[model samples]
Target: MEMQKMSNGSHHEYETLDKGIQPEEESFLPEKTDTGKKIQFNDFEGKTSFGMSAFNLSNAIMGSGILGLSYAMSNTGIVLFLILLTAIALLSSYSVHLLLRSAGVVGIRAYEQLGLRAFGQPGKILAGVIITLHNIGAMSSYLFIVKYELPLVIQAFLGQTSSSGDWFMNGNYLIVIVSVTTILPLALMKHLGYLGYTSGFSLTCMVFFLSSVIYKRFNIPCPLEAFGNFSNNATIPEDTCTAKFFTINQETAYTIPILAFAFVCHPEVLPIYTELYNPTKRRMQGIANVSILGMFVMYLLTAIFGYLTFYANTEAELLHTYSKVDPLDTLILCVRVAVLVAVTLTVPVVLFPIRRALLQLLFPEKAFSWIRHVAIAVCLLFCVNLLVILVPNIRDIFGIIGATTAPCLIFILPGLFYIRIVPIEQEPMSSRPKIQAACFTSMGFLFMTMSLTFIGMDWMSGEKRSGGGH
Candidate 1:
């Protein structure tokens, strides 16, 4: 619900096959195991039961970025699109269950602790790095989107050309403004307990963003035409949603690498689950169901609306989705600004961990204080600024971060942690966890390989098209 915070970082332990391995179902079945040491948070004064705290963690996790998910799914094709969305959702939910199980058995409150418990010191450090980098990538992308979209709307309203180099439009310049406006409020505030109501604001923005697209498409007098009917023979559109993009043919080789990037957020889930005080089996199940269901619906709605709004003309710069529609559409513009700001503000919240980890690793004896918080905030701002300047294209920025780092957070680290330390180490099924972890590692490795290949190829392709050739 809240956008900003001061002086905090969280480690999320997750892993993928650092190649293409899948989570094996065999590992999840219970086995005779050591009852873990009772673990409890020291700050338990305002502890919330698992069922009690739906406030905004899931809502935060299910944010404006997900609104664009359906469009991404559409690129995969109706069948593959649905399949990928469903598969990723199920896997993501299962990942939460695995994380919860890991915590319950190890008495580890933070995700890093689970990594350390399972994989030794190296494991903990590795997990921390993955989560940190993945989040950094995420935050930077958000900054780019906010800086890029919001000012363009303002300029459009003023009937002035947006200067790409202008102070208001430059990615880094906008980062400073948005970060200060958004993050400063959150950082200055304490008592995050009361922020549940903020999720309502975010939820409203999300709802309006979708409804605007739906309304506009329908008002055009043919809502179904927005999707352009499922054609059996017509040549597909040239833009992303064109049917040609979804093939099991040669292009399939190119897609698997991006899969690693798209399927992440595993690290963030455990912290939310751990905060669920003394959860029962049923309560935990409820949290998982609610979180997953909310995410699924948001992703599906946003993606479909994005595709319809953009249709065959969807550009790599998704801001066009808003710009192409009449600029005078006041409701749509409001929705755009709200969603953009929400996504932008999330950067500081996500980045809180890396700053903390860096501090802990570099200076362990110090107390958390105003000076420390300011220093970390400044450092993170610098990092974000550098990213915004270097990576001007928000989509490409996401690809870099999501492809290069997200897999580490999502699949490889979590999988490795589960396999390395099973609660039922005495049982034969404990071996299954190792296999499952190996699969996750394989997935990560596959992603790394593909990311390098595609990035290199994508870069080369851009060069070829730009230098006096078509």
Candidate 2:
């Protein structure tokens, strides 16, 4: 009655039930009854449809990253930003396809398991650590949104003046309330497939946020308009609403990494593939393509509209820029609330891979336990909440995580795994797959090095500016 760990870290007594059959072999064989007729397990069969899976994957891809895209556009300008975003989305979709092909070839479902099959325990640990760091960074960014935006939203709703020091007006207290009331319950789900409902709703909230941005693009007064006196004969600046198409500056290097972060949903890709109805490499890839394309459109529109509205003045977080204009504006308040809800719901979705990674690392031999699941979910939320409160700059968090772990997960690991796992006979040195893998791996490393260098330069320049001011 020895137990075996499933690819997802859940354990089942396969040795006792199947008389020492390996799980990979069992995956391909059909069950038969006493009368020799094939038996079916509809409950165990994949139940998620293409649309639902795409929605869930799309939700995973789109997060608080959208909030910073305008700032990204400011860095790279509109034309270059769009080009980089398109390239990143295409490369990301290709990376998912590589992972899917690797999984399909080995008949494995979980990402860590695929790593184990490729490079054994070290590979598994690498996959787990990358997933952990990438996901924790994501969850913290979402809560960071909650920490900064929710209090302003509460103030707008209650008509409370900014000078008030009420406990209810505290962002820390509001984020805690949101984490407890909204995020924790959803994070406790034992299976990733069950999150489709909330994921769909979360995506809807993001759509609402996008729509609000488009609406405000035309409605909100420009920065100069807010400062100008209407009774006097003051003319608005001619360049106030002009869009910048191209720019090169120190900040431009961060734009690609930020866009890469927007599309780093690889940790959830295999889990979603496993739950997909009639799961196949092609079908799961279709889901990834659809999800990535949808998010790409949403991101382009959000960045364009938000950037057009603010032009050169777009802040790192778009919502904060809105608050400065008029926190009490009804539509602006609604937009803030939509973004807050979107990010809050996103926290739980990001938690899935982190919990799965920890399970693989710590308790691979143990079966799924309700106590462990709840405790881990609570601890993760608490730790991320603390980080969100302590971290003052969201852009720095985004840049560090997006530059380092994101590229590794999105571009490097999948390509390297495919090259190693897929037989040399199937993909030789001259083969297209091998060439593509090499290109992907090289691009990832180049981007990682350049991003880190630019971020360091930005930090140094900021320090110089501060020292000069003093």
Q: Alpha carbon lDDT of residue 181, candidate 1? A: 74
**Cα error, candidate 1, residue 133 (Å):** 1.4
Q: Which ten residues in a row have the lowest lDDT in candidate 1?
A: 1-10
Model 2 residue 342 distance off true place after TM-score fit, in angstroms: 0.5
> For candidate 1, lDDT tens digit of each residue in 1-470?
00111233222322332123222322221232245433233233334554334544554455435544444544454467566667766766656666665564443445666766877777667667767776776676666667667776776566676455566655556667767777655643332323444544665666677677677655543223334553556665555334333535433444344333444545545544545555443466576667667756766666665666555444333445455545456776777787775665455445555664555455544555777777777777777777777764555545566666666665666666666555443323446655666776786677677766766777877741100000
TM-score of 1: 0.74
For candidate 2, the TM-score is 0.86
State each model's CA lDDT, in order: 0.55, 0.77
- In candidate 2, residue 122 scores what lDDT? 98
Give candidate 2 regions above 4 Å deviation.
Answer: 1-44, 221-223, 227-238, 390-398, 463-470
